[model samples]
Target: MNFIKVYTLTALFSAFTLIQATHANAITAPPLETQVKQVAQWFTGLFDNSQQVATNPSIPLITLSSCSVALTNTNPVTGTENIYLEQKSINRFRLYSFSQENSAVNLSIRAFDTNYSVTGLCNRPESEHTLDSSKVLATSCNLQLLWEPTDYIGNNSPNGCPTSSGGKVISSVTVSENGIDSLDKIFGANGNLLFATPIEFRRVDSIPEPSFTLGILAIGFWGTSKTILRKHKQKSTVSEESLFNCD
Candidate 1:
């Protein structure tokens, strides 16, 4: 009886230890703010858009070098903050607004013609007529980025965006540790596909190594705990069978 009591207590202690270890190893996602910031940082970098024109030869040939996304200031009136300014060239730029909606990150893109200058009769003075106050040339499709276990998949609204070229543009982007994949489809007013292509941009930089190391460590700990628990269970079962046979 005493031996049985000792064995039962030991088993209970082992189970408790296993539970504790497993709980500790469990990885919890970072706060929404942190996630948004991380994603924003990931998006801000130089990219090559040459592949876009390569995949679709019909599209007008544009300068593909020096494509980049940079952080910008928040809007004061409309509160429609400009999180990232995506510059394709001296003439073409896209202002992006990023926000956290529940567990997902949403992106709204607005096209701008940086080459154009603001004329008089505008609300802001000529001195303040910068890209921030520049008229929105076009509003692109809204994009929602769904977070996966390892990366993010993004899709644009099917409604599409009307352009000055008398067509609508639809876009989708996928972001991962490796890089970004972007797809853009332009349809004419008659609903004829004008230009469509997918472009892959290699990452110019990577996320901090400490976060990755922590994730790896957590996975290892969880796996080790599971193995330990399984072995403990097998040993407990064998010991119980031997004790029963003796009895």
Candidate 2:
């Protein structure tokens, strides 16, 4: 009877211990946010293809200035979209008014030769007619230039347009006075831009590890308690049986 009680207690204790351990581990688990950021920084540095994957701009003695991508598309055949950019005192460019004839087919495209230069655009030179198609549809599309918002606004004012600093033009792009849907279609169809380009950034928040650790600990405690209770029951049963047999 004692042996039976001991074995039962041992099994109960082990199960309790296992449960407790699992709970503790869960509570201690790391949050996904920190992990993601760490991974992003590491990978961004590794590829860093910003410089290597450049194309040449048209116009003599001109080079295309590298601009940060506000938006991009892996596929762009479904709708037109706008890419917005600001060049400090020069111009707030909007690559707007893109659209496609057909929304059903997937667009595939290659890089064209008529790359743009920052200064060349300021000069208002005619768009170069490249041997390459001006834009293509496909796996991804890049933004080289965009429409000028400040110019659009100033051109509309009852009051005169704002003067820019250092003789450079400064303009702002407003939420289109036209509804977003109409604007989207205009931008999309105007030249086959991406369908939806919202002017906001999506920030993912990080979670701390301590909370996870605590949760794990709680699970472990519950498991251990159950195990202890089971062992106690088995011991009581064995004791009762032994006394009955002795009598």
Candidate 3:
């Protein structure tokens, strides 16, 4: 009787819990490369906030230009999207390296603004597509960006980075299909998070390609999600039956 009871407990526990453990392990976040491509497509094209500045006199007038580039970086990171960004007269180049653990797309930014040769290269069609990666100096992980469901938001990491004036400085950016809204959340003299002054940018160029791609990707995700749920439910049913038949 004791042997039978122990055998039943061991087999029943194995039957139910093992399948669940495997299923949980099977569930994985979507691929990072796909999200990176999505951001690249969305982030392309020129943007400006002239209308916002017109309404709010206190707000600064800003213009932004961004285009994707392919760099032969010495410290190459897989699945990184390189982009050239210009805001007013200050322009910078960045390699946006991506990773994913959940629904969010996380990235670490590597800037190469010090490489002057690549400056203004974003304008040339052929140049914007490739770069002399050997000339660009590798930069530290200065900031982090995250793609939320509807938009991408950026924030400086760890403690706020230092500045030339000995104060901390940080920047945030929100990117959507139609516009880019940026706000640098500042802290008061007392070290609390203060009000943020935003600089918004509306798209200056059209991106029909990305819009169509986004639609296709959404449909694929929906179908894939439904299939996964159905499979797991079916497996659970089979596992339950098997456990009952244990002798």
Candidate 4:
């Protein structure tokens, strides 16, 4: 009976430790604020096709400057941020709003046209990086991005974003710590590919990769707990044998 009790207790303890080990190994995503900030940081940079254009000169000299502006008033994500991206190649501008739902992050994009052409807007002060809600157009196709290992990839549904010319647009964007990849396709009403621009860019200013945080979280606690639990089981077995054998 005593041995049974001890064995049962040991088993329960082992199970509890295993649970801890599992929790330690489990990848718990960061809080919404932290995650939003991280994505915003990845997007806010001067990205140009310096390397890509060198290899294929045909690729357009696309310089994308994105900056994050903290929302103060009536935005969907008022406290988070609104990302403003200016494409220097074609004098185009875009606005992005981000929100989090569970483990996924959503990106809401809109084509913004101010009264005048805006160039080098990202480099300006934070106060000047915004526009009134009137400048924001309504495009309901929000890209649901998933963190695929090291990159966030997402695209709109088929014929989701429509062009003013009554054509359809399929847009895809990838955000990575290294850089950004974006491709936009405008299909005519007849399903013919009218225009497509695939742009690959590397951050002009290099930044440290934040993957080490996940590596440490995934390996640090569970590994130590697993080792200690194994040693503990071995010691407990040896102690029990010696205790019973002693006359």
Candidate 4 Cα deviation (angstroms), residue 34: 3.1
What is the C-alpha local distance difference test score of candidate 4? 0.54
- Best to worst by TM-score, what's the order? 4, 3, 1, 2
**Candidate 2, superposed: residue stretches over 4 Å from native:** 41-247
TM-score of each: 0.51, 0.20, 0.58, 0.65
When sorted by lDDT, best at the front, the candidate numbers are: 4, 3, 1, 2
lDDT of 2 by residue, 56-173 (tens): 1111111112111112234332333222122222122222222322211111112212243333332332232111113322223211111222111111112211111111111112
State the lDDT of candidate 1 residue by residue for 1-247, as single tens digits. 9999999999999999999977755554566655555555565434443454466544322221111122225344331224323223222334455567777776665544546442221134423423543455443446667766556676654765555446555666676665666665655668776445455555444443323211100000000122323443443221110100000
Instruction: Give the CA lDDT, 0 to 100, for residue 79 in model 2.
Output: 32
lDDT of each: 0.44, 0.22, 0.48, 0.54
Worst lDDT 10-window in candidate 2: 215-224
Question: Model 4, stretches more than 4 Å misplaced?
Answer: 1-28, 70-79, 113-117, 207-247
The better-scoring model by TM-score among 1 and 2 is 1
lDDT of residue 216 for candidate 1: 9
What's the lDDT for candidate 2? 0.22
Between candidates 1 and 3, the TM-score winner? 3
* Ranking 2 against 3 by TM-score, winner: 3
